[model samples]
Target: MQESWRDEVSLLPEELKEILDITAKHNRWRKYETINLIASENTMSPLATSAYMSDMMHRYAEGKPFKRYYQGTRYVDEIEVRVMKLMGELLRADYVDPRPISGTTANASVFRVLGKCGSKAVIAPVQAGAHVSHTKFGTLGALCIEHIEMPYDPDQMNIDVDHAVKLIEEVKPSFVVLGASVYLFPHPVREIADAAHSVNAKLVYDAAHVLGLITGKRWRNPLDHGADLLTASTHKTFPGPQGGIIATRDGQLYKPISRAVFPYFVSNHHLHRLPALAVTAVEMKHFGEAYADQIVRNARALAEALAAEGFKVLGEHLGYTRSHQVVLDVRKQGGGAKAAQLLEEANIIVNKNLLPYDPPDAIKDPSGLRLGVQEMTRYGMKEDNMKDIARFMRRVLIDGEDPRKIAEEVKAYRREYTKVHYCFDVNTLEDGKLYLLY
Candidate 1:
């Protein structure tokens, strides 16, 4: 006797049900269950998340503020103007364009405004932290720009200022890009800017990873240090909804950059993020200093603890890190790929990274692991929590504990620190309500 189809089936299709179930589970795991250490990721505050889900998401307001090509965009213009003003005030820049959708898009806009196809630019080596956007394979290639690698000093985990200055002079490129994805120390922006200017080259600093730290006064502001332009993604340490901004102290570059942003890089500009970005900007204005300080403290603490736990933490001579990240040389623990996989199995998330000595092809299985403490710090984890996290990693990698058992312990530890801090809150939501976007 076959059962009725109604008795055996859900109201929704099985495929849709499975997708919804998987999404819910993923959200539960990533948000409330696992310890996230990815360097390029962060959680938005509840207030900011609320702003991210507006009717603006369904609308479009092409072109610049007060000059849109579409109708019904007066409010969108206001939001964009407010967001730009907030960003400019936060970064101390004369002009800010909050249009580009990602840091790479911001870079592309800069590339378009600075030079045409087949132009040359000097950029940091990938090992020293230059983002892919600055490389020939990313935005540069798309723009038909030639990429000249900057001289990197691996011991300091920064650029070789003397050699870089010489390279900039010798290459005399149209622009010189400063900043890195794996940045531990601040670049020699003033010195490089001087050299770039001497060579008639512009300096574009990609502050995607450390934008929050810079705003919070924990790191040097490149614009203040003589960079002509700066680009950043609002997510990472900035803790905003995903978006990119281009800021400059030079007002003369405004028109070119604005034109490049609209017709070249973006259309409509994702109006939904504008209000959320404004919320985050306000949050940074109020709590960024304390938040950035805690992130750096936690990163250093985690690096120290990991080193004590027999992990080969990088930049030990430079006090581990000045930013929110702590890199590990995982060669001793079976290389970065294996170590990252094992850590993930234990519910400790991190990413494999290329060491300074690694070949470019080793990207598939690099020799280092990149761990960030910014998101964890936002979740109210402190220096002591960093020690516990290091212990978990030690147990998984050194003691050879079963990953499944460690994952259980991880879930328990994570349960204690679920609230997001460093932002304004009305506290109007119900208890146990999931406010996180991921």
Candidate 2:
């Protein structure tokens, strides 16, 4: 560590000191204590963090690798190409653009590439947990884009394919975005793509939350289903660093997409950090299948356990989740934000999400809490782990109703699960310091 950095981090008011101290403590705790269920968060490998906090984030090499707008990109060129190769192989893409900066930018790049102006597109409503990158800010200042919502069967809360087909026929959009952050079932991508193709609209899948599952074949592959492009965040289920990826099957579309990203949507790009993504891609190639499989198993197990404990987990009503996420309709327990706050008090981390067809007016405190299996799966939890976690929920929300006591129980539970375990020589930290092994 740098000497100046030590002093810089230490130079804070006593109150601020206490806050930063605990925040650092929680980083260690997240490395050490409690279960992590947030679907969108995960523990990146130490090497990946090393790539960021240690070196790469500071390097601001402008423009593309090799052909930079500035100079001294000799090594950065190699790094970017290598990262692109790893990502292509991992995603099975004909071409890969690793410089979209985030999933939103990736989608924005897709939009910019597929249209000139006044182009139509289809997506799930954001209230249904679709990302804003596709349905919100991504289009706010877009290329004269028109946003259309995916049809959903209100009675079933799943995609209303018949209605979607009818709308695709009506709009004949330039692109159709097949994605939803919260909808738990596998979308019939091939079916959706077929519908879009009949109207000559390009198909793009925003597999932001479920890419890891798809990579493992645990979820449907948009590529096989005729998607022209796939975009996702590296952190969510890929469990890598925080960034985005864009992949496409058409060689013809690659340069236009690259052109859209360069000199337009993104400028001067972070050339040096591509190696961090390179390292993550390498790691994913090795453990993705196993990690993905474990995540799905954990989701189903947790869902069944939660349902048996009397929580209204949504998936089981039709088919249990085929992915890592599960939704608890917590309206019966309390409003979602309130339920989430209660869970957080007990050292359980989850987020409030809107249920299908929830009113737009109930924005802040929707009626659902979203959970995922990726982080718990990292701590070596599985089917049996769900039983204990569900019991913990039942105790606080159903029986004892004392969140303080639940916190104690949660801590006790954390101790049982995270005790002295290592993968590739990494374990969660218990004290203020991080250690490779204990």
Task: State which candidate has the highest TM-score.
Answer: 1
Tell me the tens digit of each residue's lDDT in model 2 across 1-438.
Answer: 599997987777889989888899987566555667888887666655555553444466556667777666677678788988888887788788888777888888888878657677888777766776676345534566877888877556667888888898988888888777885786768878898889888888888898878776678778877888898877788766677888988988878888888767777555434766776677777777887888888898899999999999885766678788998888888789888888878878888888875886676989888898887786778899888888888777777488877887777778766632113333444554543122
Please report, as a residue range, the 10-residue window in candidate 2 with the lowest summed lDDT: 419-428
lDDT of 1 by residue, 132-196 (tens): 89988888988899989999988888899999999999889999999889988899999999999
Residue 35 accuracy (lDDT) in model 1: 98
**Which 10-residue window in model 1 sums to the lowest lDDT?**
429-438
Cα displacement (angstroms), candidate 2, residue 364, comes to: 1.0
CA displacement after TM-score superposition, residue 240 of candidate 1 (Å): 0.4
Candidate 1 residue 143 C-alpha distance from true site, Å: 1.3
Among these predictions, the greatest lDDT belongs to 1
Summed backbone clashes in each candidate are 2, 1
Misplaced by over 4 Å in model 2 are: 1-22, 136-144, 268-273, 416-423, 426-438
Cα shift from native, residue 251, model 1 (Å): 1.7
